[model samples]
Target: MRLLASSLLLLCLSAYSEGTVISKEPGESIHLTCSSEECPTYSNEYHYLYLYYTIDEEAEVVFSNIKSERFSPRGKYESRTKLDIHNRTITLSNLTASDTGIYKCVYKKSSTEKITCSVYAVFITEKTPCSTVSPAVEPSPVLMYIIFVCIISVLAMWILMLLILPKVQQRFIKRRAMHAHQSSADNVYEIMRREEGAQVAAPIGLV
Candidate 1:
């Protein structure tokens, strides 16, 4: 009986000393068991169970058993943690990278008797979100100014052509009309000179 009890104690102590590593992504949940099996049952009045997490060598209490069946959570875990005494587990939800650490449960059976349960080394990996929206690029003021200048120049050239084309056409038509009148006058004068020459030459021959 004595040997059997000592072996059982050794087994329990070995189980407590063993460590477990748990890995998860951010915003996920994890269940941390205090012991491999159900935690040693104790009277409600004498039971004092607390869960703690350590990060960057700093430890803080996560779950605290107030009295018999009452419990309280501290700090950032006020709403994200759920403690199940019946299952001897603590479920931490909505995990983040800052929550990566070592977690352990401590049970104070009496004033001088305390038991620390299994330790969990938790690792929370943060995934960066991919962006599909393209960044807004501002229009270059110099480019815009150049485009505006080009448009204005084209419009100015078109308006200038519209104003000058009718004047050019009128000048061309007037020059054509003057040249036609000069040609007609020259043709009539040449015919009159030829008729006078013929009359003078013929009358002299007849006389």
Candidate 2:
């Protein structure tokens, strides 16, 4: 009988050390387990279990054993929360972005012993596309200045061409007139030299 009692006590101690609360995502159910092995004259009598949640600096009691299905919330959380003591689980439906927080489970037994466990619940928050809706992505002032400079350069080149074309045409006309005058003077000098040579040949023949 003593050996049996010793074995049962060891088993109960091992089970009491195994209570745990698992971390879960928001909008999903989480199970908290409090178990003990068979022991003589020791019935598992839990007085109450409290579930608490803190979200964004607001604290609230999510579940309690006194009211099985009557866990209340401040606002916008009346119908979205549920607690089941039979399964030691808490279910939150249609979780929103504001549901991300820490959850703690406290269990009180009739023997005045308390067991506590904690888990983190994370809710996904949808963020807007920052790259598409920003006004800072407009065209830079440097790019606009570069475009203006290019336009000014093109206009300056066009004006320079207009100013140089008339001077080039006048230079070409003067060169052509000077060439014609020189050719006419050379032709008159050649005719006079030819007449002198003819007179000299006629005199030699007469001698």
Candidate 3:
């Protein structure tokens, strides 16, 4: 019994020591393996695998074979995460600006046995046209001066119209009143001549 217990302890230690990592770029897949050289049954007991990513002082379990638990992701790593249990691989697809970081794999043999390994990954995202260069564009001095001159011209025209329009209207009204008074005086003189002709014709008829 004492020899059997010692053999079991050695088997467990050997199983924990066996781990391999495959490096991959962003938007690619990475495989992690935990197996034992001595015991075939111990190597096959891969119950679950947990994949974690860390960027900008934040760490999160992005993928896991055990699906019922809640996993929290920080920074811009809340999405674009996946895991495959049959092949022991984690795939981060459609990577973006925030996928550049260190990624780790944790293998869980059972409720108690666990092992971990980590690798560094980098993602080079394309920059926009505005962010790539510096020195912001400024409007030309000639354009600014032209705009100022246009505004001043428009204001001066408005002020001139406001000052001249009322005086012109008053002058036109006075001319119309003078013309009407002259027409009335001419009609009165014609009526007086007709009355004088009627009186002279009546005296000739009596004679």
Candidate 4:
């Protein structure tokens, strides 16, 4: 009995040596395969196949399947895993850093005898931080058109001011000259009237 138990333990330990390492980043998915070759009696007999993994060194059952029947995923793995009994595969999706551990596929023949058919060491890498500086984006055509319109409007206003200012100044100068000529003529007429009045007063004094 001791020899049989020791051989079974040795066989289970040997299964770990043939494990493959799967590396993935967060939010990604991975498929772990367990074909009939891994569990020889899988195709011949209708036994229970279980997907197990370690969490903090404790074994946790992820999925359980029996031949053609539907498999049930346990705990939080219910939403993250999909089991295909026909293909003998289990897919874990939306992976996170916490999912890094040793995953095992076991063939359970009896309550006392369980064989590890395949093993997988899953490693979820940490996400790299994004750069702080954003890439330079080209200005949109609508924005460029608005800027061009604003520049043209300012230039048109300046040109209108330059053309109108000289004409306004010329009109002001012509009005001032006419006002000065009228004032000079009025002053000359007043001086002549005063001189004639003075001459008439002197002749009356002599008479």
Instruction: Return the top candidate by lDDT.
Output: 4
Candidate 1 lDDT over residue span 146-168, tens digit each: 33444555668678789788889
For candidate 3, the C-alpha RMSD (Å) to the true structure equals 32.2
Q: Per-residue CA lDDT of candidate 4, range 31-90, in tens?
A: 988774657565556377788886335566564656556688887788888877677788
Measured with C-alpha atoms, the lDDT of residue 199 in candidate 4 is 94
List the pairs of residues colliding in candidate 2.
Answer: none
Q: Least lDDT summed over 10 consecutive residues: which range in candidate 1?
A: 5-14
Better of 2 and 3 by lDDT: 2
What C-alpha lDDT, on a 0 to 100 scale, does residue 174 get in candidate 3?
93
Query: Which 10-residue span in candidate 2 carries the lowest summed lDDT?
Result: 33-42
* lDDT pick, better of 1 and 4: 4
List TM-score per model, in order: 0.48, 0.36, 0.34, 0.51
Q: Best by TM-score, which number?
A: 4
Q: Candidate 2 — what's its lDDT?
A: 0.50
Clashing pairs in 1: none
Q: Least lDDT summed over 10 consecutive residues: which range in candidate 4?
A: 1-10
lDDT of 3 by residue, 1-207 (tens): 323332332333223224332233345533333222321232556445556664334465454444343343344545655444444445555564344334556656777886665443432223326556654444335333433444555568677789787788889999999999999999999999999999989989999
Q: What lDDT score is found at residue 100 in candidate 3?
A: 39
For candidate 1, the clash count comes to: 0
